[model samples]
Target: MAEQQRLLGGRYLLKEKVGTGGMATVFRAQDQVLNRAVAVKIMLPQYAGDPTFAARFKQEAQAAAALQSPYIVGVYDWGKDGDTYYIVMELLHGTDLKSGVRSHGALDPKKVAQIGSQICGALSIAHKHEIIHRDIKPQNIMVQPDGNIKVMDFGIARAKNSHLTQDNNVLGTAHYVSPEQTRGQELGPTSDIYSLGVVMYECATGRVPFDGDDAISVALKQVNELPVPPSQINANVDGDLERIILKCMEKDPANRFQTADELRQVLNSYLAGRAVDVPEPTRVIAGMAGAGGTEAMRMGDKTQTMVRPTAPGDTASNPVIRPNNQINTSSYDNEKHGMGKGKIAAIAIAIVAFVAIAIFAVSGFLNGGDQKSVPNLLGMGQEAAVASIKSSGFEPGNVNQSYNDQYSEGQVCEQTPDGGKTAAAGSKIDIVISKGPKPIDQVEVPDLSNASDLDEAKKIIENAGLTVGSTTQEANDADEGKIVDQSPKAGEKVDKGSKVDIVVSSGPETDSVPGVVGKTESDATNTLSNAGFSVNVESGGTSDTYAKGYVMKQSPTGTAKKGSTVTIYISEGKDTSSDEVDVDSLGLTGMTAEDAEEAIANAGLKYDPRQQSSSSVEVGNVIKYSPGGKQPAGTVIILYISTGPSE
Candidate 1:
């Protein structure tokens, strides 16, 4: 129960719970310092206590915080207080996609595409940073009151630099998982596209594509079954929209949209009523894996011939077609209708002659040909690798470059027919070069503490490639609207898009201690704290008017410095003749006469009660009392009770 009101980082005040999920509980909270409302998501105890889960949760939240996009839910702050880990995010007053669907089944196709497109926009940003949202489903998408979409829950997202998911332990909703995810294969942005496709399909058709009694069955269907098209479920679904959904749900990751940005472009085109280049539905041939599995209905009657490389260590005297006819090979039967003996001999002789020439050319034993083994070009710069290749009797062929996080830019990563392979002089060799780690902007933070104008300081910070974070107003000697202090201090090196908090001067603090008299001690302390003042509670002499535990007086009540300490005196009730009487004193002005008598008896005082007629007092309730101050432990005075209004 204490967790309900727990203050985190001395800033966020957790209020009533608003939501609960498998991983976290969300509460409506107040950012005390900012004096604004926020949503605080606290990890459940099970996850918070586990170091592995806690670290991953923190990393994901930090990654989300770094990403700034309108289509994505914003992460304000994240921190741990004692055993509880929490994340503060923008408090959205809208329903999740699931709730929307439940309330209004089968949304409009155009709206579905629009929502999917918005999510794709968010994904585009995340994917550019090499972050993949492993889980994308209706429940994780928030639909704002204004009909805008906000993609959420990157809790399972993993950066490209991190290792793959735990084998066989898929970390996503089964119904929306991609085939690769089900197979425990490597994942990329395409996986997210597939999940979004599922979401789009559900939004357009009022149900998930695959469903079963349990998660395992649903997962198997995701891996090995074709989903009924949205158009089939709901005839209102547009053909173009259905095509886009099918393309995103393609079984092979390679067949799906390569990037979220690509999907967004297609969606935009569809919304614009422009011609979209949607690929025709692919068919699953026998002994082949297609987007929708082997049993999927053929999209066309056209048969496609696919040539495959031989298996590793497959030994054969010659290429021969097996008789089961299970695989697609050459249609002609050369064995049944053989060539003449003279023709076969001639062909064999030609092959022998070619082999002899190739061997001799490589050995440089004939025709005065110079041949040498290729040099080790890997890890060398492109220019150096080319020079080495030329010096070793080989010419550098087409150079293919790709971004690599591990290799430096322009370094040779691979060479066809690799190093040490024998090649004739002046032979062309192809090499693959690294374009280096993806460029991430880093800049030195500009000093803004001395900036006199907040707007000007913000401009300067933006020029230095940083964003102005929350601005706090504090009382100081510096001019108002001027920066009094900053976080990541001036001259500190930080990420290019890092947010820096600044405190602006609101002028000298001339805070006056508020009147907390008659308030409970707890209420008084809270009042002082809210006023930017620290408070100390002290016991005050008993008062006849004030009740026990209530604030009677305070020190330095008129004017004091902001954040200055104040002492609040609490009432101990009326002073009594005996210590026992003081401890047993009771306030019975609001109590019924019977209740007052019972309290007096319990406090060891004699119960002397009498009835009185009064116009203002309620019937049988306490009206007046004698010896209002505490008396001897066994001493009692007259007690008057009202008997309705006087006649």
Candidate 2:
């Protein structure tokens, strides 16, 4: 049967293979139960049988499913059918970031920052959950049609508390792995930030920061080499963006942005046209193998022996035999020599002594006849130290460089054999050169003014290579729970791992608004105003319980912010339903139009004068009026006036 027709877990019907990776193959499939299309990732048969890989695969599904964000691909389901293990995820329609970058060269600096900000948002959520995305290469980022990105493939992400031995070997793509990851060191959110830095670098330069013929070579570079500034590769890259990217790629985790959110803030600030405060990128001292060379080997907790490949006509590949140390006298027969056993023993001893003396004389001649004291090369420059060793009758063996706090760079920090110690002439003396004191990692204090809450401020402070010193709450105009102040303020240069103190706002001061339901309007206003609240008065129509001009209702009857407005309603007295108007008082029959209007105005009723042709009454006179009965004040009164006789 064709692969597309095959069904897994009796629910996911495989359609077509969409992509393939080192550990699994992704297929666009239909989810029968949900009746929707999804991307199903099936573990390759080779890895599916391995218990460790299987467990990690399951973990990927669980971890990705737990994270819900627009920038993160959603995981729906995962299961095993027979020997096949598959995971179903939201199907996306966009090319991977790697493919896009390859098709189109380096992107605009602003575009790169925007993409980075989105990715950081996704990482911020994951890091908060204690999960580190071991792999963060362009291949795992999908650039959607709308220009937003969704991070995919949490296959190698390891939770902080995970016991899986999956990290026995480096897990991420070598070109983008962090230095600590290359050395198999413990990883945290910073490790992921390092990888993100590489991604942004690649996005800005159209190439990876490090590359070689093989993964090991690339991995070694990640640990030892400093990346060439992105601006060099792409001059369009601005200084601010380049520094942000390089900061992410710092060799030391302490030197890199401590948290994804911290990096995200910087990127967002750049995008928002705000000034960014990123320091210059760190430069790591070249390792023993020097920069950009594969000769250096990195060994982590596990011991590794690197064997050089044999070259043509290499003598080291061949084995050699050495003669036994003991003198052999099997060829000499005492009986044939016609000597007694005692005599033969003396002869043998004499021969052995003569040979020993001859050997000693030859060794003495080869070693310049005598022993000499090794020179005191300590504190001497490397070149001077080597020269001194030669002049002092000693040969310089191996010269190695190490970080020494007590010595300056290029000075000899230590030497084998003390200056007074005697060694045979021509013996090799080893020396260690100083590379200077290890550079103290420095980190900039992050601006905490934008922090929304104390917890967020703490994360920002800790992520910026500082510790939260203490937190105090103060009443202020700033919103409650917001960070209002900080110590050793942002933009200060401090040693990495320093402490920072912060202050949190408890919101504005407030006072109780006194109840004014039964008080007069003037008294109610005074009561509210004296309590530090501004008063606003409104009419409360006809309240029988409260007398006229008295407060009937009030808003915010309890505690309220000081200087805030308080609304009070004044009663308009009891209802006048019992009052009525007499019908005869209006008097409109046979009256003039002007006279009728005056009568309506006197009674507090509105006048509505209408014209009609009247033959029985005088012209321009009021002929009749309708509905002459009790009416409320402001009610319209309609009167028919004579418009002379109708034509």
lDDT per residue (tens digit) for residues 1-647 in model 2:
77689898989999999989988999999989879999999999999999999999998988888987768999999999989889999999989999999999899998898799889989998998888998999999999886879999999997777887446478899999998888988888998999999999999999998999999999987877667778768878877898899889888788889988899878866764558999866543444322342222223332122222222333222223323321112232335655756567779999999998787667666767587767888789989998999999889999899998777899988888877566888899999999988876878889998988888899998778777754545678899998888766789887776667677888877778899889989998888888888889999899779999999899987777789999999999999855555445767888888988898878777778898998898987888876587877777777888888778
C-alpha root-mean-square deviation, each candidate? 23.1, 19.9
> Which 10 successive residues of model 1 have the least lDDT summed?
309-318
Off by over 4 Å in 1: 163-168, 285-647
The digit string of per-residue lDDT tens for model 1 on 133-174 reads 989999999988767778888888878776434433588999
What TM-score does model 1 achieve against the real structure?
0.47
Clashing pairs in 2: none
Residue 188 displacement in candidate 2 (angstroms): 1.0
- Clash totals, every prediction: 1, 0
